[model samples]
Target: MKLESNLPKQSPWLYTAPLLNTILLLLVYFLFTSDFVVQSGISVEHPESNSRLTGFDRAHIITVAAGTDSALYFDGLRISQPELREKLKANREGERRAIIHADKHAPHGRVIEIGNMALDLGYEVAYSTVPPKS
Candidate 1:
């Protein structure tokens, strides 16, 4: 005795639908979960310089903002000069280096003061500047 089957063959799309859906879902998931690029640090218009220097491997960043207020930032946090001194003293285990990011419009006296403070703390100081626009 011979037996006959009565099922219809499925289309190629039916076999691929789940895979396509999984790929599309993965794409959407990554698009929604991934972090976008953000510009970090205190905004400052650095003075132009012709010379280029390598950045320190491990250093404290002191940012001096423009305007009459002349706000001071130590390692991205707003801080007073004395507070900065204390913080620097506390973080003296590693290489002692300070990078000053001063705005072009910021007062020269304040920059000098911070530089002096860093020097007093026995830290090698370097000023940050942008390359001259050609």
Candidate 2:
């Protein structure tokens, strides 16, 4: 009798309104943006600087693979410099950003070339870095 009185007959979901709201908000956040997932072929040897990024959400991802040689890849599609620029120009009419994932041992010149090209296309460049191994 005491237990029955203590337990309300209302909907269980109603009892957890605050918790439900929090979970709903989190779901919406993750759905709207890619926050915790990383997609790249970069190695575990990026030089870390004292720089901190403000917001690096779903920016355009360009991977420069160093398997056989230096090759330009946009979202896994092989593209030339001019093609890359054209694609960027089409997709990015407003402010946009780019993330470059280069091999750890890739030549600096190649990486810089890609960075310069992205900058020339009016996209902010961000280098993908990994935490140093302990």
Candidate 2: tens digits of C-alpha lDDT, residues 15-112: 79999899999999989787567675444346655656757677877877665577777866788777888888897565488888887777788889
Alpha-carbon runs more than 4 Å astray in model 2: 1-35, 41-51
Stretches of candidate 1 exceeding 4 Å from the true structure: 1-40
Judge candidate 2 at residue 130 and give its lDDT: 64
- TM-score per candidate: 0.68, 0.63
lDDT of 1: 0.86
| lDDT scores of the candidates, listed in order | 0.86, 0.77
The model with the greatest lDDT is: 1
Candidate 2 residue-wise lDDT at 76: 68
lDDT of 1 by residue, 10-83 (tens): 79999899999999999998998675422228999989998766657467788999999899998789998889
lDDT of 2 at 5: 67
